[model samples]
Target: MPLGTLDRDPPPFFRQGPSALSKLAVCSALAFFLMVADARFKVMQPLRVVLATVLYPAQWLAMRPVLVFQHASQYFSSLTAAQTAQQEVLRKHSLQSQRANQVEQLSLENERLRKALGLRERLQSPSVAAQVIYDAADPYSRKVIIDKGMADKIALGSPVLDESGVLGQVTRVYPLVSEVTLITDRDHAIPVLNTRTGARGVAFGDVSLHVDAMELRFMAANADVAEGDLLTTSGVDGVYPPGLPVARIEKIERRVDAVFARIYCVPLAMVAGAGHVLVLEPTNAQIPARPAADVPAVVPRRGASR
Candidate 1:
Protein backbone atom coordinates (compact mmCIF):
# COMPACT_ATOMS: atom_id res chain seq x y z
CA MET A 1 0.00 0.00 0.00
CA PRO A 2 1.25 3.51 -0.93
CA LEU A 3 2.12 5.70 2.06
CA GLY A 4 -0.23 8.49 0.88
CA THR A 5 -2.99 6.01 0.36
CA LEU A 6 -2.63 4.69 3.93
CA ASP A 7 -5.23 6.10 6.28
CA ARG A 8 -3.69 9.15 8.01
CA ASP A 9 -6.86 9.41 10.03
CA PRO A 10 -8.50 6.54 11.90
CA PRO A 11 -11.51 5.00 10.22
CA PRO A 12 -14.87 6.58 11.20
CA PHE A 13 -15.43 3.90 13.79
CA PHE A 14 -12.13 4.73 15.50
CA ARG A 15 -12.37 8.55 15.17
CA GLN A 16 -10.98 10.70 18.01
CA GLY A 17 -13.45 12.39 20.35
CA PRO A 18 -13.46 16.02 21.58
CA SER A 19 -10.16 17.60 22.73
CA ALA A 20 -9.03 17.13 26.34
CA LEU A 21 -9.30 20.92 27.00
CA SER A 22 -12.89 20.92 25.72
CA LYS A 23 -13.74 17.94 27.96
CA LEU A 24 -11.99 19.59 30.89
CA ALA A 25 -13.81 22.88 30.35
CA VAL A 26 -17.16 21.13 30.04
CA CYS A 27 -16.55 19.04 33.22
CA SER A 28 -15.43 22.09 35.21
CA ALA A 29 -18.46 24.10 34.09
CA LEU A 30 -20.72 21.20 34.99
CA ALA A 31 -19.00 20.84 38.37
CA PHE A 32 -19.37 24.60 39.06
CA PHE A 33 -23.04 24.47 38.15
CA LEU A 34 -23.61 21.44 40.34
CA MET A 35 -21.83 23.11 43.25
CA VAL A 36 -23.94 26.25 42.82
CA ALA A 37 -27.10 24.18 42.56
CA ASP A 38 -26.14 22.22 45.67
CA ALA A 39 -25.41 25.41 47.53
CA ARG A 40 -28.62 27.14 46.46
CA PHE A 41 -31.18 24.36 45.82
CA LYS A 42 -30.05 21.38 47.96
CA VAL A 43 -29.44 19.34 44.86
CA MET A 44 -27.34 16.14 45.30
CA GLN A 45 -27.51 16.40 49.13
CA PRO A 46 -29.34 13.07 49.49
CA LEU A 47 -26.88 11.46 47.13
CA ARG A 48 -23.92 12.75 49.17
CA VAL A 49 -25.51 11.43 52.37
CA VAL A 50 -26.16 8.04 50.81
CA LEU A 51 -22.56 7.80 49.50
CA ALA A 52 -21.11 8.80 52.90
CA THR A 53 -23.28 6.26 54.73
CA VAL A 54 -22.35 3.48 52.40
CA LEU A 55 -18.55 4.23 52.58
CA TYR A 56 -18.49 4.82 56.33
CA PRO A 57 -17.53 1.29 57.33
CA ALA A 58 -14.64 1.22 54.83
CA GLN A 59 -13.34 4.62 56.06
CA TRP A 60 -13.56 3.50 59.68
CA LEU A 61 -11.67 0.29 58.96
CA ALA A 62 -8.93 2.21 57.13
CA MET A 63 -8.44 4.68 60.06
CA ARG A 64 -8.47 2.10 62.88
CA PRO A 65 -4.65 1.40 62.99
CA VAL A 66 -3.76 5.12 62.86
CA LEU A 67 -6.24 5.97 65.65
CA VAL A 68 -5.02 3.06 67.79
CA PHE A 69 -1.36 4.09 67.41
CA GLN A 70 -2.13 7.71 68.43
CA HIS A 71 -4.23 6.59 71.41
CA ALA A 72 -1.52 4.21 72.67
CA SER A 73 1.16 6.91 72.50
CA GLN A 74 -1.03 9.39 74.34
CA TYR A 75 -1.91 6.85 77.05
CA PHE A 76 1.76 6.05 77.83
CA SER A 77 2.67 9.73 77.95
CA SER A 78 -0.24 10.55 80.26
CA LEU A 79 0.65 7.65 82.58
CA THR A 80 4.24 8.88 82.97
CA ALA A 81 3.00 12.44 83.63
CA ALA A 82 0.49 11.22 86.21
CA GLN A 83 3.18 9.30 88.09
CA THR A 84 5.44 12.34 88.13
CA ALA A 85 2.61 14.54 89.40
CA GLN A 86 1.82 12.06 92.18
CA GLN A 87 5.43 11.99 93.32
CA GLU A 88 5.54 15.77 93.38
CA VAL A 89 2.44 15.91 95.49
CA LEU A 90 3.81 13.35 97.93
CA ARG A 91 7.08 15.25 98.29
CA LYS A 92 5.27 18.48 98.99
CA HIS A 93 3.13 16.82 101.63
CA SER A 94 6.17 15.34 103.34
CA LEU A 95 7.91 18.67 103.47
CA GLN A 96 4.80 20.37 104.82
CA SER A 97 4.46 17.75 107.57
CA GLN A 98 8.04 18.26 108.68
CA ARG A 99 7.62 22.02 108.77
CA ALA A 100 4.41 21.72 110.75
CA ASN A 101 6.12 19.54 113.34
CA GLN A 102 8.98 21.99 113.69
CA VAL A 103 6.59 24.90 114.05
CA GLU A 104 4.67 23.12 116.80
CA GLN A 105 7.85 22.32 118.72
CA LEU A 106 9.07 25.88 118.43
CA SER A 107 5.72 27.21 119.59
CA LEU A 108 5.86 25.03 122.71
CA GLU A 109 9.42 26.08 123.49
CA ASN A 110 8.55 29.71 123.02
CA GLU A 111 5.63 29.43 125.40
CA ARG A 112 7.85 27.92 128.08
CA LEU A 113 10.44 30.66 127.67
CA ARG A 114 7.77 33.37 127.89
CA LYS A 115 6.38 31.96 131.12
CA ALA A 116 9.85 31.78 132.64
CA LEU A 117 10.57 35.38 131.68
CA GLY A 118 7.30 36.62 133.16
CA LEU A 119 7.94 34.83 136.45
CA ARG A 120 11.39 36.34 136.69
CA GLU A 121 10.01 39.83 136.12
CA ARG A 122 7.35 39.54 138.84
CA LEU A 123 9.76 38.49 141.57
CA GLN A 124 10.94 41.14 144.11
CA SER A 125 13.92 39.37 145.59
CA PRO A 126 17.15 38.50 143.80
CA SER A 127 16.98 35.13 142.16
CA VAL A 128 19.14 32.83 140.11
CA ALA A 129 17.42 30.92 137.37
CA ALA A 130 18.12 27.22 137.59
CA GLN A 131 17.09 24.17 135.62
CA VAL A 132 16.20 20.87 137.19
CA ILE A 133 19.19 18.63 136.70
CA TYR A 134 17.80 15.34 137.93
CA ASP A 135 15.66 13.85 140.65
CA ALA A 136 17.29 13.22 144.01
CA ALA A 137 18.70 9.79 144.56
CA ASP A 138 16.77 9.15 147.77
CA PRO A 139 13.37 7.79 146.82
CA TYR A 140 11.99 8.15 150.32
CA SER A 141 11.77 11.96 150.01
CA ARG A 142 10.36 14.15 147.27
CA LYS A 143 13.47 16.04 146.27
CA VAL A 144 15.04 17.32 143.08
CA ILE A 145 18.55 18.48 142.18
CA ILE A 146 18.99 21.85 140.50
CA ASP A 147 21.77 22.91 138.20
CA LYS A 148 22.77 25.78 140.48
CA GLY A 149 24.73 25.10 143.67
CA MET A 150 27.34 26.68 145.94
CA ALA A 151 29.29 27.71 142.89
CA ASP A 152 26.32 29.80 141.83
CA LYS A 153 25.76 31.17 145.34
CA ILE A 154 22.69 29.05 145.94
CA ALA A 155 22.46 29.03 149.74
CA LEU A 156 20.89 26.44 151.97
CA GLY A 157 17.22 27.00 152.79
CA SER A 158 16.85 29.23 149.77
CA PRO A 159 13.28 29.47 148.52
CA VAL A 160 12.51 27.81 145.16
CA LEU A 161 9.66 29.02 142.98
CA ASP A 162 8.17 28.14 139.62
CA GLU A 163 5.86 30.23 137.51
CA SER A 164 2.82 29.17 139.49
CA GLY A 165 4.01 29.27 143.11
CA VAL A 166 6.61 28.18 145.64
CA LEU A 167 8.07 24.77 144.84
CA GLY A 168 10.55 23.87 147.52
CA GLN A 169 13.65 24.94 149.46
CA VAL A 170 17.33 24.18 148.87
CA THR A 171 18.46 21.73 151.52
CA ARG A 172 21.88 20.51 150.30
CA VAL A 173 24.23 22.63 148.19
CA TYR A 174 27.19 21.07 146.45
CA PRO A 175 29.81 22.76 144.31
CA LEU A 176 27.83 22.44 141.07
CA VAL A 177 24.39 21.24 142.10
CA SER A 178 21.87 21.61 144.90
CA GLU A 179 19.12 19.37 146.24
CA VAL A 180 15.72 20.93 146.81
CA THR A 181 13.19 19.36 149.13
CA LEU A 182 9.77 19.80 147.60
CA ILE A 183 6.97 21.31 149.65
CA THR A 184 5.26 17.92 149.45
CA ASP A 185 8.05 16.16 151.25
CA ARG A 186 7.28 14.42 154.50
CA ASP A 187 9.58 16.72 156.49
CA HIS A 188 8.62 20.01 154.86
CA ALA A 189 6.43 22.59 156.56
CA ILE A 190 5.35 26.14 155.86
CA PRO A 191 3.31 28.64 157.80
CA VAL A 192 0.48 29.76 155.58
CA LEU A 193 -2.15 32.49 155.92
CA ASN A 194 -5.63 32.02 154.59
CA THR A 195 -6.12 34.42 151.72
CA ARG A 196 -9.91 34.54 152.13
CA THR A 197 -10.20 34.55 155.93
CA GLY A 198 -6.77 35.95 156.96
CA ALA A 199 -6.43 33.08 159.46
CA ARG A 200 -2.96 31.80 160.24
CA GLY A 201 -2.23 28.09 160.10
CA VAL A 202 0.77 25.80 159.92
CA ALA A 203 0.82 23.60 156.79
CA PHE A 204 2.71 20.37 157.23
CA GLY A 205 3.43 17.80 154.51
CA ASP A 206 1.51 14.64 155.29
CA VAL A 207 1.98 11.19 153.67
CA SER A 208 -0.23 9.12 155.90
CA LEU A 209 -2.55 8.02 153.07
CA HIS A 210 0.20 7.07 150.58
CA VAL A 211 -0.44 10.31 148.75
CA ASP A 212 1.49 13.55 149.15
CA ALA A 213 -0.53 16.43 150.56
CA MET A 214 -0.38 19.35 152.97
CA GLU A 215 -2.39 19.22 156.17
CA LEU A 216 -3.33 21.97 158.61
CA ARG A 217 -3.18 19.93 161.79
CA PHE A 218 -4.73 20.98 165.10
CA MET A 219 -7.04 23.46 163.48
CA ALA A 220 -10.18 23.82 165.58
CA ALA A 221 -13.23 22.00 164.31
CA ASN A 222 -15.07 25.31 164.08
CA ALA A 223 -12.28 26.92 162.09
CA ASP A 224 -13.33 29.01 159.09
CA VAL A 225 -11.55 26.65 156.67
CA ALA A 226 -13.29 25.78 153.48
CA GLU A 227 -12.53 24.07 150.22
CA GLY A 228 -11.03 26.14 147.41
CA ASP A 229 -9.31 28.52 149.85
CA LEU A 230 -5.96 29.79 148.68
CA LEU A 231 -3.06 29.68 151.09
CA THR A 232 -0.06 32.02 150.98
CA THR A 233 3.21 31.95 152.84
CA SER A 234 3.09 33.85 156.20
CA GLY A 235 6.86 34.56 156.27
CA VAL A 236 6.93 33.53 160.00
CA ASP A 237 9.46 30.75 159.42
CA GLY A 238 12.17 33.11 158.15
CA VAL A 239 12.71 30.83 155.18
CA TYR A 240 10.03 31.56 152.52
CA PRO A 241 9.28 35.08 151.38
CA PRO A 242 6.01 36.74 152.34
CA GLY A 243 2.96 36.75 150.05
CA LEU A 244 4.08 33.73 148.03
CA PRO A 245 1.50 31.19 147.05
CA VAL A 246 1.81 27.90 148.90
CA ALA A 247 -1.18 25.66 148.36
CA ARG A 248 -4.92 25.59 147.85
CA ILE A 249 -7.34 23.85 150.18
CA GLU A 250 -8.70 20.77 148.52
CA LYS A 251 -10.71 19.07 151.24
CA ILE A 252 -11.82 19.76 154.80
CA GLU A 253 -13.18 17.16 157.22
CA ARG A 254 -14.62 18.27 160.52
CA ARG A 255 -16.21 15.76 162.93
CA VAL A 256 -18.49 16.78 165.82
CA ASP A 257 -16.52 14.73 168.32
CA ALA A 258 -13.02 15.55 167.05
CA VAL A 259 -11.35 18.69 168.38
CA PHE A 260 -9.22 19.24 165.28
CA ALA A 261 -10.24 19.54 161.68
CA ARG A 262 -8.52 17.66 158.84
CA ILE A 263 -7.64 19.98 155.99
CA TYR A 264 -5.92 18.72 152.85
CA CYS A 265 -4.29 21.10 150.38
CA VAL A 266 -2.85 20.75 146.95
CA PRO A 267 0.41 22.54 146.21
CA LEU A 268 0.17 25.13 143.48
CA ALA A 269 3.63 24.53 142.18
CA MET A 270 4.28 22.12 139.30
CA VAL A 271 6.28 19.77 141.42
CA ALA A 272 6.39 16.92 138.91
CA GLY A 273 6.70 18.91 135.70
CA ALA A 274 8.78 21.93 136.64
CA GLY A 275 11.61 22.43 134.16
CA HIS A 276 12.94 25.75 135.50
CA VAL A 277 12.77 27.45 138.87
CA LEU A 278 13.90 30.57 140.70
CA VAL A 279 16.12 30.21 143.74
CA LEU A 280 15.69 33.22 146.05
CA GLU A 281 17.78 34.30 149.01
CA PRO A 282 16.63 33.12 152.40
CA THR A 283 14.29 35.58 154.11
CA ASN A 284 16.21 35.17 157.37
CA ALA A 285 19.34 36.54 155.73
CA GLN A 286 17.40 39.68 154.78
CA ILE A 287 16.28 40.41 158.36
CA PRO A 288 17.86 43.46 159.99
CA ALA A 289 20.27 42.88 162.86
CA ARG A 290 19.12 43.65 166.42
CA PRO A 291 20.08 47.13 167.73
CA ALA A 292 22.46 47.39 170.73
CA ALA A 293 20.05 49.66 172.64
CA ASP A 294 17.37 46.96 172.58
CA VAL A 295 19.46 44.61 174.75
CA PRO A 296 18.37 44.29 178.41
CA ALA A 297 20.87 45.06 181.23
CA VAL A 298 21.54 42.38 183.83
CA VAL A 299 20.24 43.37 187.41
CA PRO A 300 22.85 43.52 190.27
CA ARG A 301 22.06 41.44 193.40
CA ARG A 302 21.25 43.46 196.67
CA GLY A 303 21.79 40.57 199.12
CA ALA A 304 25.22 41.85 200.17
CA SER A 305 23.76 45.07 201.60
CA ARG A 306 21.23 43.10 203.69
Candidate 2:
Protein backbone atom coordinates (compact mmCIF):
# COMPACT_ATOMS: atom_id res chain seq x y z
CA MET A 1 0.00 0.00 0.00
CA PRO A 2 2.88 2.55 0.78
CA LEU A 3 4.46 1.90 -2.70
CA GLY A 4 1.18 2.72 -4.60
CA THR A 5 0.55 6.03 -2.59
CA LEU A 6 4.10 7.27 -3.23
CA ASP A 7 3.90 6.75 -7.05
CA ARG A 8 0.52 8.54 -7.52
CA ASP A 9 0.25 12.49 -8.04
CA PRO A 10 -0.58 14.71 -5.02
CA PRO A 11 -4.20 16.03 -4.37
CA PRO A 12 -5.37 19.55 -5.65
CA PHE A 13 -5.04 21.08 -2.10
CA PHE A 14 -1.24 20.37 -2.21
CA ARG A 15 -0.64 21.28 -5.90
CA GLN A 16 1.86 24.14 -6.82
CA GLY A 17 0.32 27.30 -8.39
CA PRO A 18 2.33 28.71 -11.42
CA SER A 19 5.82 27.67 -12.58
CA ALA A 20 8.83 30.21 -12.05
CA LEU A 21 9.22 30.83 -15.82
CA SER A 22 5.53 31.65 -16.26
CA LYS A 23 5.47 34.10 -13.26
CA LEU A 24 8.62 35.82 -14.54
CA ALA A 25 7.08 36.28 -18.02
CA VAL A 26 3.86 37.78 -16.59
CA CYS A 27 5.72 40.29 -14.25
CA SER A 28 8.00 41.49 -17.15
CA ALA A 29 4.97 42.07 -19.42
CA LEU A 30 3.18 44.07 -16.67
CA ALA A 31 6.27 46.28 -15.97
CA PHE A 32 6.72 47.00 -19.73
CA PHE A 33 3.07 48.09 -20.06
CA LEU A 34 3.33 50.37 -16.97
CA MET A 35 6.51 52.03 -18.34
CA VAL A 36 4.85 52.61 -21.73
CA ALA A 37 1.74 54.14 -20.13
CA ASP A 38 3.79 56.44 -17.90
CA ALA A 39 5.92 57.63 -20.89
CA ARG A 40 2.94 58.27 -23.24
CA PHE A 41 0.27 59.68 -20.88
CA LYS A 42 1.94 60.20 -17.43
CA VAL A 43 -0.44 57.70 -15.95
CA MET A 44 1.64 57.24 -12.70
CA GLN A 45 2.35 60.94 -12.02
CA PRO A 46 -0.35 61.33 -9.33
CA LEU A 47 0.71 58.09 -7.68
CA ARG A 48 4.38 59.15 -7.56
CA VAL A 49 3.47 62.50 -5.93
CA VAL A 50 1.40 60.71 -3.31
CA LEU A 51 4.23 58.31 -2.54
CA ALA A 52 6.85 61.15 -2.21
CA THR A 53 4.58 63.19 0.08
CA VAL A 54 4.07 60.16 2.32
CA LEU A 55 7.87 59.47 2.55
CA TYR A 56 8.97 63.15 3.07
CA PRO A 57 8.87 63.05 6.93
CA ALA A 58 10.97 59.87 7.03
CA GLN A 59 13.59 61.35 4.61
CA TRP A 60 13.88 64.56 6.68
CA LEU A 61 14.30 62.64 9.96
CA ALA A 62 17.06 60.48 8.46
CA MET A 63 19.07 63.62 7.27
CA ARG A 64 18.79 65.64 10.56
CA PRO A 65 22.15 64.55 12.12
CA VAL A 66 24.14 65.20 8.92
CA LEU A 67 22.58 68.72 8.49
CA VAL A 68 23.21 69.61 12.19
CA PHE A 69 26.89 68.57 11.96
CA GLN A 70 27.45 70.69 8.81
CA HIS A 71 25.80 73.78 10.36
CA ALA A 72 27.84 73.55 13.58
CA SER A 73 31.13 73.20 11.71
CA GLN A 74 30.33 76.19 9.47
CA TYR A 75 29.40 78.41 12.47
CA PHE A 76 32.68 77.68 14.33
CA SER A 77 34.79 78.33 11.21
CA SER A 78 33.10 81.71 10.59
CA LEU A 79 33.55 82.79 14.24
CA THR A 80 37.29 82.02 14.20
CA ALA A 81 37.78 83.93 10.91
CA ALA A 82 35.96 86.99 12.32
CA GLN A 83 38.21 87.08 15.41
CA THR A 84 41.36 86.90 13.24
CA ALA A 85 40.11 89.74 11.03
CA GLN A 86 39.45 91.98 14.07
CA GLN A 87 42.98 91.43 15.41
CA GLU A 88 44.50 92.33 12.04
CA VAL A 89 42.55 95.60 11.87
CA LEU A 90 43.67 96.64 15.38
CA ARG A 91 47.32 95.94 14.59
CA LYS A 92 47.18 98.05 11.44
CA HIS A 93 45.57 100.95 13.33
CA SER A 94 48.34 100.97 15.97
CA LEU A 95 51.08 101.05 13.33
CA GLN A 96 49.42 103.98 11.54
CA SER A 97 49.21 105.97 14.79
CA GLN A 98 52.97 105.64 15.43
CA ARG A 99 53.83 106.73 11.88
CA ALA A 100 51.61 109.81 12.20
CA ASN A 101 53.43 110.96 15.35
CA GLN A 102 56.83 110.62 13.69
CA VAL A 103 55.65 112.67 10.70
CA GLU A 104 54.46 115.53 12.94
CA GLN A 105 57.78 115.79 14.81
CA LEU A 106 59.76 115.83 11.57
CA SER A 107 57.61 118.63 10.19
CA LEU A 108 58.30 120.89 13.18
CA GLU A 109 62.08 120.33 13.09
CA ASN A 110 62.21 121.11 9.37
CA GLU A 111 60.42 124.44 9.85
CA ARG A 112 62.86 125.69 12.47
CA LEU A 113 65.86 124.85 10.33
CA ARG A 114 64.48 126.73 7.32
CA LYS A 115 64.03 129.95 9.28
CA ALA A 116 67.60 129.80 10.59
CA LEU A 117 69.07 129.49 7.10
CA GLY A 118 67.12 132.51 5.94
CA LEU A 119 68.61 134.69 8.68
CA ARG A 120 72.15 133.78 7.64
CA GLU A 121 71.59 135.14 4.14
CA ARG A 122 70.52 138.62 5.28
CA LEU A 123 73.59 139.61 7.31
CA GLN A 124 76.28 141.97 5.89
CA SER A 125 79.31 140.98 7.98
CA PRO A 126 81.36 137.79 7.66
CA SER A 127 79.51 135.38 9.95
CA VAL A 128 79.55 131.80 11.19
CA ALA A 129 76.38 129.86 11.94
CA ALA A 130 76.15 128.04 15.28
CA GLN A 131 73.51 126.15 17.20
CA VAL A 132 72.76 126.89 20.84
CA ILE A 133 73.69 123.75 22.75
CA TYR A 134 72.20 124.69 26.10
CA ASP A 135 71.64 127.41 28.68
CA ALA A 136 74.60 128.44 30.81
CA ALA A 137 74.91 126.80 34.23
CA ASP A 138 75.02 130.16 35.98
CA PRO A 139 71.42 130.85 36.95
CA TYR A 140 72.07 134.45 37.99
CA SER A 141 73.24 135.46 34.48
CA ARG A 142 71.27 135.27 31.28
CA LYS A 143 73.75 133.36 29.14
CA VAL A 144 73.78 130.54 26.59
CA ILE A 145 76.42 128.16 25.26
CA ILE A 146 77.02 127.74 21.55
CA ASP A 147 78.37 124.70 19.73
CA LYS A 148 81.15 126.71 18.06
CA GLY A 149 84.31 127.90 19.84
CA MET A 150 88.01 128.62 19.10
CA ALA A 151 88.08 125.52 16.92
CA ASP A 152 85.42 127.16 14.75
CA LYS A 153 87.35 130.49 14.68
CA ILE A 154 84.79 132.12 16.97
CA ALA A 155 86.41 135.19 18.57
CA LEU A 156 85.51 136.70 21.93
CA GLY A 157 83.33 139.88 21.94
CA SER A 158 81.72 138.81 18.67
CA PRO A 159 78.09 139.89 18.31
CA VAL A 160 75.54 137.08 18.18
CA LEU A 161 72.17 137.38 16.50
CA ASP A 162 69.10 135.22 15.90
CA GLU A 163 66.43 135.40 13.24
CA SER A 164 64.64 138.27 14.91
CA GLY A 165 67.56 140.46 16.09
CA VAL A 166 70.62 140.72 18.34
CA LEU A 167 70.74 137.96 20.97
CA GLY A 168 74.06 138.31 22.77
CA GLN A 169 77.85 138.74 22.53
CA VAL A 170 80.40 135.97 22.90
CA THR A 171 82.19 136.66 26.16
CA ARG A 172 84.34 133.54 26.64
CA VAL A 173 85.76 131.04 24.14
CA TYR A 174 86.58 127.36 24.66
CA PRO A 175 87.89 124.54 22.49
CA LEU A 176 84.58 123.06 21.43
CA VAL A 177 82.12 125.65 22.68
CA SER A 178 81.71 129.30 23.61
CA GLU A 179 79.65 131.30 26.15
CA VAL A 180 77.45 134.19 25.04
CA THR A 181 76.09 136.74 27.46
CA LEU A 182 72.61 137.71 26.35
CA ILE A 183 71.75 141.39 25.92
CA THR A 184 69.34 141.04 28.86
CA ASP A 185 72.09 139.82 31.20
CA ARG A 186 72.87 141.99 34.21
CA ASP A 187 76.48 142.55 33.17
CA HIS A 188 75.80 143.38 29.52
CA ALA A 189 75.34 146.86 28.01
CA ILE A 190 74.63 148.11 24.52
CA PRO A 191 74.66 151.55 22.92
CA VAL A 192 71.31 151.98 21.23
CA LEU A 193 69.89 154.85 19.21
CA ASN A 194 66.20 155.61 18.88
CA THR A 195 65.17 155.19 15.28
CA ARG A 196 62.25 157.63 15.52
CA THR A 197 63.99 160.55 17.31
CA GLY A 198 67.70 159.71 16.71
CA ALA A 199 68.23 159.85 20.49
CA ARG A 200 71.39 158.09 21.65
CA GLY A 201 71.56 156.36 25.06
CA VAL A 202 73.31 153.55 26.89
CA ALA A 203 71.04 150.54 27.34
CA PHE A 204 71.87 148.16 30.19
CA GLY A 205 70.34 144.79 30.99
CA ASP A 206 67.49 145.00 33.48
CA VAL A 207 67.73 141.53 35.02
CA SER A 208 67.09 142.84 38.55
CA LEU A 209 63.76 144.34 37.57
CA HIS A 210 62.51 142.25 34.64
CA VAL A 211 63.47 138.95 33.06
CA ASP A 212 64.26 139.90 29.44
CA ALA A 213 64.48 143.67 29.29
CA MET A 214 66.94 146.57 29.02
CA GLU A 215 67.02 149.89 30.88
CA LEU A 216 68.03 153.38 29.79
CA ARG A 217 69.95 154.26 32.97
CA PHE A 218 70.43 158.07 32.81
CA MET A 219 68.08 159.53 30.22
CA ALA A 220 66.53 162.88 31.04
CA ALA A 221 62.96 162.87 32.32
CA ASN A 222 61.89 164.96 29.32
CA ALA A 223 63.69 162.74 26.84
CA ASP A 224 62.07 162.01 23.47
CA VAL A 225 61.82 158.25 24.33
CA ALA A 226 58.29 156.85 24.02
CA GLU A 227 56.55 153.48 23.90
CA GLY A 228 56.76 151.45 20.69
CA ASP A 229 59.95 153.28 19.66
CA LEU A 230 62.46 151.02 17.93
CA LEU A 231 66.11 150.99 19.09
CA THR A 232 69.11 149.90 17.06
CA THR A 233 72.84 149.64 17.58
CA SER A 234 74.59 153.03 17.32
CA GLY A 235 77.91 151.38 16.19
CA VAL A 236 79.86 153.61 18.65
CA ASP A 237 80.73 150.74 20.98
CA GLY A 238 82.92 149.11 18.27
CA VAL A 239 81.28 145.73 19.06
CA TYR A 240 78.04 145.45 17.07
CA PRO A 241 77.47 146.62 13.50
CA PRO A 242 75.44 149.75 12.83
CA GLY A 243 71.72 149.56 12.05
CA LEU A 244 71.17 146.15 13.71
CA PRO A 245 67.96 146.03 15.76
CA VAL A 246 68.37 145.57 19.52
CA ALA A 247 65.16 146.31 21.41
CA ARG A 248 61.92 148.26 21.51
CA ILE A 249 60.89 150.82 24.11
CA GLU A 250 58.01 149.23 26.04
CA LYS A 251 57.44 151.50 29.08
CA ILE A 252 58.64 155.01 30.05
CA GLU A 253 58.02 156.40 33.53
CA ARG A 254 58.62 160.09 34.18
CA ARG A 255 58.54 161.49 37.72
CA VAL A 256 59.20 164.97 39.05
CA ASP A 257 61.40 163.74 41.90
CA ALA A 258 63.52 161.42 39.74
CA VAL A 259 66.08 163.01 37.45
CA PHE A 260 66.12 160.20 34.93
CA ALA A 261 63.17 158.57 33.19
CA ARG A 262 62.89 154.83 33.78
CA ILE A 263 62.69 153.27 30.31
CA TYR A 264 62.01 149.55 29.90
CA CYS A 265 62.83 147.95 26.56
CA VAL A 266 61.97 144.50 25.33
CA PRO A 267 64.49 142.71 23.18
CA LEU A 268 63.40 141.79 19.68
CA ALA A 269 65.18 138.43 19.55
CA MET A 270 63.94 135.22 21.14
CA VAL A 271 66.63 135.30 23.85
CA ALA A 272 65.61 132.16 25.75
CA GLY A 273 64.37 129.98 22.91
CA ALA A 274 66.83 130.70 20.09
CA GLY A 275 68.00 127.45 18.53
CA HIS A 276 70.36 128.79 15.84
CA VAL A 277 72.47 131.97 15.91
CA LEU A 278 74.87 133.96 13.71
CA VAL A 279 78.20 135.07 15.17
CA LEU A 280 79.44 138.20 13.42
CA GLU A 281 82.98 139.60 13.23
CA PRO A 282 83.65 142.59 15.47
CA THR A 283 83.19 146.03 13.87
CA ASN A 284 86.83 146.93 14.62
CA ALA A 285 88.07 144.06 12.46
CA GLN A 286 86.00 145.27 9.51
CA ILE A 287 87.09 148.91 9.73
CA PRO A 288 89.79 149.90 7.25
CA ALA A 289 93.14 151.11 8.66
CA ARG A 290 93.83 154.80 8.54
CA PRO A 291 96.76 155.88 6.37
CA ALA A 292 99.74 157.59 8.08
CA ALA A 293 99.90 161.35 7.53
CA ASP A 294 102.85 162.67 5.52
CA VAL A 295 105.69 164.06 7.67
CA PRO A 296 106.05 167.84 7.60
CA ALA A 297 108.96 169.11 5.58
CA VAL A 298 112.11 169.74 7.69
CA VAL A 299 112.48 173.21 6.25
CA PRO A 300 109.66 175.50 7.22
CA ARG A 301 108.28 178.03 4.81
CA ARG A 302 110.02 181.45 4.86
CA GLY A 303 106.83 183.21 5.91
CA ALA A 304 106.30 180.85 8.93
CA SER A 305 107.07 182.31 12.42
CA ARG A 306 109.96 180.74 14.43
Evaluated with TM-score, which candidate comes out highest? 2
Model 1 Cα lDDT, one tens digit per residue, 1-306: 778888677688765788889999999999999999999999999999999999999999999999999999999999999999999999999999999999997787577667767977877778899989789888888999999988999999999998888899999999999999998898988889999999998888877643657887779999998999999999889988889998998988999999999998988988877878889999888889877786688777988664
Residue 48 accuracy (lDDT) in model 1: 96
Clashes of 2: 0
TM-score of each: 0.62, 0.64
On lDDT, the leading prediction is: 2
- Tens-digit lDDT string for candidate 2 (129-214): 89899999998999999999999999989999987789999999999999999999988999998999998998899965678889
Which pairs of residues collide in candidate 1?
A: none
> Can you tell me which runs of candidate 1 are displaced by over 4 Å?
1-106, 208-212, 293-306
lDDT of 1 at 258: 97
